[model samples]
Target chain A: MITAMSDASAPPVPGFVESTFSPLVHAAVHRCLGVAPPGDGARTAIVLASTVGDATTLDTGSRSLVAGQAHQPLLFMQSTANAILGRLAVDLAVTGPLLSLSTAVPDDVAGELLTTGALLLETGEADRVVLVGVELAAGDRAAAAHRALGTVPPAEDLAVALLLDRDDPVPHLPELPAHPPPAAPPDGYGTLRGLVALAARNQGTPP
Target chain B: MRREVLLTGYGVRTAFGTGAEALRDGVFDGRPAFAPVTRFDTGPYRTDAAATHGPAVPLREVLAETAAAAVRMAGLPAGARADVLVGTAGDFTALTRFWRTRGRDADAGGAAGSDGAGGAGVVETVPAWQAAALADALGVRGTRLAFTSACVASAMAVVHGCLLISSGRADTVLCAGAYLVEEENLAKFGSGFALSRDGAVRPFCADRSGLLLGDGAAAVVLESADGARRRGARPLAALTGWGVAGDAHHVARPHPEGAGLAAAAGRALRGAGLPRVGYVNAHGTATRHNDPAETRGLRAVFGPYADSVPVSSTKSTTGHLLEAAGVVELVITLLALRDGVLPPTAGFTEPDPLCDLDFVPNRPHKADLRAAMTVNAAFGGVNTALVLERT
Candidate 1:
C-alpha cells in the first residue's frame, strides 16, 4: 500500500552557497516535505540519493590546504552527504531515520530508492518516506575527472524529489525523458537528468 | 508470513586481517592495532596515529575481496545473485587527490553544471557511485542501496538488509561496510578534536582521551532461515531484530542522557521480545562525551539488567572503525555468542564514576551468552541497535 509523487525544478534555496550542491537539494526537499503531514514528521523518513555529493566543498577545502592555507571548517562540515539531510530534519522537524545513499548506475538507483522507501512503509519503520535524488552537474573539474577516468560525463544540476506512503490513493507521475545510454555513460546520469525530466514532463498533471 | 533473517556466513578485513577467527583471537588476546598513520603525511595534526591498512587499495578491489570471501564462506554459489547494500564514508583519498590535482584552480564562484562545463578535466570521487562500482566488481547484483550515515552507516545498512529479507524482497542479501584510514579523515577528525591526543583507545576508562580511527571492512551474508536450511548452511546466529532512532539534539554531540540511544535499544529489545539483554557491545568511543552518554543509555534501557549484563567496548582493541564499526562489532558479537566467550575491553586502567557498568575490562570472560546486542551511534544524532540471539 504505497503511493508516490515526484517534483523537479525547485527554485534555489536561500542562505546557502549558490555554487554548492546542498542548497539545491534543500530547495527540492523543501517543496516536497510539505506533502507530509505536519507533526507526523517524527515518524517520517528522509533518504537522499546522490552520485557526486557536495564535491565542491571537498574541492575547495583540499585545494586550500594544498595551497598552504588553513582548511575552512565550513567546507568540511558540508562535505558529508548527510549534511543537507541533517538541516532538513531540523527545519522540517522530521526525525525518523534520516539517511543518504550514492551509486554509479542511475536507472536502477531510482527504482531501488523507491523500493527501499516502500519497504520502510511496509515494515512500519516510518509512516512516510521522502526520497530525493540529486546529482552534481558536470563542472569543469568534474568533466575533466570523468575524462581522466575515461567515462562519459554526468548531466549538470539535476534533482528530483518524491513523497511516498503506504496504501494511499495517489496518481503516478509521468515517465522520465528517454535517452539512449551513452557508451560507457558516466555514473549517476539517470538521476541527474533522467529523473528531472520525468518531473518536468509531469508538471501540469495531477497527483 | 514474516521471514526470519539468519546470519549464514560472515567475513571481515580489519586491521587484524581477513576472517572472523583472526578478529576474535585478536580481541581476546587484548592486542590494540593503533599505530602511526602511514597513508599520507599527518605532520600538521596533533597526532599522526591511526589503525591503517598499510598499503593503498582501491574501493573495487576491497569490495571484491571482502564480498567474495563472505560468499564463499556462506557456501553460496560463486555466481549466486544477492541484493547489495553497502555503507561507506566516501573515498577521502580519491576526493582529496582529485580536487588537489584537477580542480586545484576550479572557479570558486562557478555554479555546478554552469555553461563553462564538460571540458574542465577534473576527476570526481563521489561516494554514491561506490555501491554500483562495488556491485560490478563483485559480479553479483540485485537491488542496490548505498548508505552514508556517518558512524552508524553500516549498522543501518544491516537493518535495511534485514527489512528486505523480512519483507520477502530477497532471500539472500549481502550487507557490508568498510572505511580506510586516510589523510583527509585524520585531518578532518583531528580538526574537530575527535581523535585521541595520545594514540590510545581506552573506552570507559577514567583517563580516556578520544577515539582512534581504524581501517576495515566487514560483510555478513543474511538469508531467510528457511533458505539457509534449504541450502544446508549452518546458521551462526539469528539477527533477531533491530532499532533505529535519531537524537535531534545536536549535529555533532550526542544527547546528554543518551535519550535516542536508549530508545533505539528499547525498540530492538521489544522487537526481539526480550525482557533482558545479556550482553552489550557498546559504541564506546572513549571520548569524554560519548562514554558518559552511552553509559546513560545503558542505565536507561537495561535498568536492573544494566549492572548484571557483561558489557565491553571492543573498540578498546580494534580502535573505532567509524562507518564499519557496527558490522564489525556485530560479527564480534556473533562470534562471542557462538563460542561462549565475552571479549575484553582493553586499556581500562581506572573506571569513571559516570560510567558505572560491569565492563569486562582487560580480560576476556568465559560466559554462556544467549542474547547479545551491538549499538552504534553516529554524528547527526543517529543511533542504531542490533539484537542477535544464539541459534
Candidate 2:
C-alpha cells in the first residue's frame, strides 16, 4: 500500500488558474501514480471519493455568472467533479475504468473509498487502482452555516490518495485507530481528516 | 452457461413524462422535444432551446420517484437488498441557486463575517453524497455509489454494477443517471459551441450544428441471473457486455479517428461473443465532430455490415441528457429490443456524406432485433458501450 496526503494549501497545477480542487487532486494522483508499478495503462483504474467535491470552482463559477462576469471556460471545466479524474487519466495514461463519487456522510466516505478499490481489483476489472479521497474545506458562507447550526465545521482543506492492488506486499498499515480529538476540528470535508489521521499513524515511528 | 446480468426493471423521468410508455410514445411521435429553455436564462447564446421537465424538480425527489418506479417494475420486495449508483454531470439548478444566493448575501454584506455557515440547501449540494441520499430515499440496504463521468457516467455505472453482480459481490443494484437544465450549464455549453446554433438538433444531417441540453433521470434494476431466477423475476433483457475507454487525446473533443470509441464498441462485442451488431444506439449529439467521428467508429466496428445494421440516435428526439445519456440510451435500447421497434432520429434531413449510416430517420421501423448496442461519449473523451440481448 502506498499513501500520500496533500496539505490544504497545495499549489494549483501550473498554467491552470481558477482551480483549487484540481490542484489537490493532481498532487495526490501524481504521488499515487508514481508508486504504481510499471504496467499496462489499460489495466489500471481510478476511483475518486469526495464529500464537498469541487465546491470551490462551482461556487466561484456561480458567483461569476451571478455577477455578470465574462464566461470563464476553465472554471466551468473544473466545476464538474470529474474534471480532475479526466486530467489524471490523460496525464498518467491510465484508462481502464474511471469513477468520481461523493458521499454525504463524512464518516462513511473513507470506508467506501477503500471498499471500492478492493472491489474493482477483486472483480478482475483492473490489476491496479488509484483511490483518492478529497474534500475542499467549505467556503466562508457554507462554513458559517455549519457553525450556526452547531456543526463541527471543517478546519482545513486536505486530500489523501492511496494506491491499492491485489496481493502487493508492503509494510501493512494497521486499521485506522479510534478518532483522535481533532485539533481545531480538522479541515476540509468528508473523510479528509480521517485519512490524514491514518496517514499520520502509518508514518509515525514503528511500534 | 456463464451467469448473466439481467435488467429486470426500468424507470424514466424525462420531458416526455414518467415511465417507459412516455419514452416510447414520445420517440415514435416523431417530434423533437427541444423548446425554449424555461429553467434558466440562456444569456447571449445563439440558442435557448432545451428539453426540460417543465419546472425545476429537486434531484432527490426525482431520484426517489424513479427508484420506486423501477422497483415496482422489477417486482422487488418492499425492502430489497440492492445497491444504488447515481450518475450526474454537474450540480443541479438548486445547487447553483444556493451558491448564487450566498454570493448575493456576500455581495450585499449580509453575512460576510458569519464564519462560513450555510443554510439547509447547502446539504444537498455536496458531491458524491447524493448517492447515499438516493439510497436512503429508496430504502436500499446494499452499497451506495455515485458517478460523474460526464456523458458516460450512468453507462459506466451500469457496467460496474453488472461487474459487481458478476463477481458475486452483490445480487442487485439500482443504476441511475440524472441531469438538470441549469443556466450555468447552458452558458458554459453555449459558450463552448456545444449547443445547436439555430436551436435545432439535426444529427447526421448535412446541416448538423450541435446538441440541445435535456433534463431527465433513468434507472434500471440489474441482478445476477441466479438471483433473478430464485426470486422468480423475469429478465427484461440481458446486459451481456460493456466496454469503457478513455480518449486521452483531447479535453472536450473526440479523437479525430474515433479510436477510443471504436475500441469500446469492439470490446463490447468481443466480450459478448457476437460477430455483428444488429442495431446501434449512436451517441449522435448532432455536433459536427461527434456525428462524423461516431460514424467512423460504427464503420470500424461493424465494417461492411455497418451498411446493413440499423443505426439511430434517439437524442434527435429526446435531446442530449449529458451525463444521463448513457443509462437513458441504454433504457431506450432495451425498450427497442422488447418491442422490436427501432426508434427514429427525429430531426434528420438531408444526409451528410460523412455520415452514411442507415439512420432510421423521422419514423420508427419495425425489425427482428436479437441484440442491440448503445454507445455514449463524454466531455472528457471517455467512451462507453453497452451490449444487451433479448431475454
Candidate 3:
C-alpha cells in the first residue's frame, strides 16, 4: 500500500546544476516526506530505479573528458547514481538499506522498484520503503543506448515517489496522467517508467 | 521467514590469474600486484601505479565469460536460467577509448555492438546494460539488477542475493562484481588527493598512506539449499546472514566513527544468530578516515572480541576494486574459509594504535576458521556486511 505519493516533472531547482536529474529526484522525495512524516529512519529503505540513470551527467562527463576540459569531481560523483541516494540517506536519516536498481527493460518483474519496496516489507527488511523512479530526457549517449536496448526513453525529466508499508491494503489505482514533457502527468504510465506509474499521479498529493 | 542459501560456485579474475588458484596466489599469498596503469596515460595523476588488468577486451565480454564460468562451476544443467546481478562501472574503459577516437558511425546501434552495443565498438555505455546482456548471454531466466553503489555495491548485491533466496524469489542467483581501473577513476582519486603516493596499499598500518585502484572481476553462485540439493551441486559454504546500513553521516566522507559500518555488521551477526565471527574481511581502504572509523565500527559491535578476531583487508593487495571490492573481497574470504587460512593485510609495515585489531598483518594465519564476516563501506555512507560459513 502506498501511504504517500508525489511526482516532480523536471522542476527547475535553484542553484542545483550538473543535471536536473538529482533535483527532480530530490523534489519528489521531499514532497512525499512532507506529506507523510518518516517514522524511523533506520527502519526505512530507499530504492531508486532507472533504466538510463542521469544520462545527461554521463554524457557531459564523457564529453568533458574527451574534449580535454577540466575534470569536475562533482560530475564524476553524480555519475554514479547512488551518490544522491547516499546524500538522501544522510538527509532523511535512513539507515536501513539504500539500493539503486538498473535494468535493461523496466517491464521485468524484478525491474519493478515499487514491488521491491513491498517485498522489503513482506520480508521484514524494512518498516517502510521510499521508492523513487526517475528518468531524464536522453542525451546523445543515452539515445544510442536506448536504441540499442530497444527501450523507449521518457519524454522528459520525470520522477515519482511512493512511500509504502506492509499494513496498507491494495492501493487505489487512480487514473494515471499521460506524459506531457515537463508537464506533471496525473498518475502513472504503469511499469514503463518503473515507479510503474502506480496510481498517485498528482504532482504533489498528500495522502 | 528464513531459508538456507548455499554458495555453490565462484569465478574470480585478478592480476593473479583466473581461477581459485589465482586468487590464492595473487591475493592470499600476501603478494602486492600493483603495477603501472597502461589503460590510460597516468602523467597527470598522483601515482602512476595500480593493480591493472592487461586485457584490451570489452567489459561485457569479461562479465559474460566470468558469469558463464560461475554457472559451469555451479554445475547448473545446460540452459539453466538464473538471475544475474553484478556491481560494476560497466564498460568505462571502452567508452574512454571511444571518446579518445571521437569517431562515429552511421549505424549507431551496430557501432555500439549487438550485445552491449557500446563495449568499445560504440561510445555509449549504460551502468545497467551489461548485466542485462550478461543474463542474456548466460540464457538465465531470473531478474537482472546492476548495483553501482560505489565500494559497497557488490557486497550489497550479495546481500540482495541472500534475501532473494531466503524470500523464495530466486533459486540460483549469479552475484558478482567487476571493476577495470580506467582514467576517469584515477583522475577522480587523483584530484581528491586520495591515491597512494607510493603506489602501495597499506590498510591498518601506521605507515599506510592511501589506496590504489585495481582491476578485478569475481562471481559467486548462490543457490537455495533445496535448489542445490535438487541439482546435486556441492555446497562450499553457506551465506548465513547479511545486512546493509547507511551512515546518514556524510556523502563524500565516512562517519569518523564508522557508525553505518558498525550498524551493518551488528545487524548481519544478529541475523545470523552468531555472537562472534572467527575472521573478519575488512573494507580497510587504508584512507585516513576509513581505517580508524572501521576500527571503531568493529569494536562497537564485538566489544572486546574485536581485539581477538583475526581481521584483514585483501584490498591491501588487490588495491581497491571500487564497486567490485565487496564481492572480490568476499571471494577471498570464501577461499580463506575453503583453505582454512586467513588472508593477511599484505602491505602492513607497522600497526596504527587506532586500528589495533589483529590485522593478520603481512602473513596468512592458518586456523580452524568456522565463519567469517566481510564488511565493506562505500563513499556514499552506505555499508554492507555478509556472514559466510564453512559448510
Q: TM-score for all predictions?
A: 0.88, 0.92, 0.91
lDDT of 2 by residue, B1-391 (tens): 2458999999887788888888888866667888897666765555779888778877777777887888888998977789898887435565566666767677788874443333545555543546777787787798777787777889988987977887788899999988877777777776576788787789999998888988778899999999999999989999988888776666667877787788788888988999676789999999988888889988988887989999999888888887788988998899889899999988789999999999999999998999999998876667899999998
lDDT of 1 at B207: 93
Query: Per-residue alpha-carbon lDDT of model 3 for B1-391, expressed as tens digits?
Result: 6899999988888777677888888788899899887766777667899987675567777677777788888998766768788887667766675555443333342343322323334422666777877787888787778887878878978988888899988898899888887777777777667889898999988888899988888889999999999989999999997989889987778888889999999999998899889999999988889999999999898987877899999988889988788888888888888899999999788888888899998988898988999999887788899999989
Per-residue lDDT tens digits for candidate 3, residues A81-105, read 6677777787788888988877666
For candidate 3 chain B, which ten residues in a row score worst on lDDT? B114-123
Mind giving the per-residue lDDT tens digits that candidate 2 earns over A57-96?
Answer: 7767677777777657777666665567667777888667
lDDT of model 1 at position A55: 60
Worst 10 residues of 1 chain B by lDDT: B114-123
Of 1 and 3, the candidate ranking higher by DockQ: 3
Taking the tens digit of each residue's C-alpha lDDT, what string does model 1 give over B68-128?
7888888987557788888886666665665454443365544434213332323325554
Which ranges in model 3 have alpha carbons more than 4 Å from their true place?
A1-16, A106-111, A170-196, A201-207, B103-124
Place model 1 in a CAPRI quality band: acceptable
TM-score of only chain B in every candidate structure: 0.93, 0.96, 0.94
lDDT of each: 0.74, 0.76, 0.77
Q: Which residue pairs show backbone clashes in model 3?
A: A176-A188, A177-A186, A177-A187, A186-A201, A187-A201, A190-A196, A191-A196, B112-B117, B112-B118, B113-B117
Ranking by TM-score: 2, 3, 1
Which model scores highest in TM-score? 2
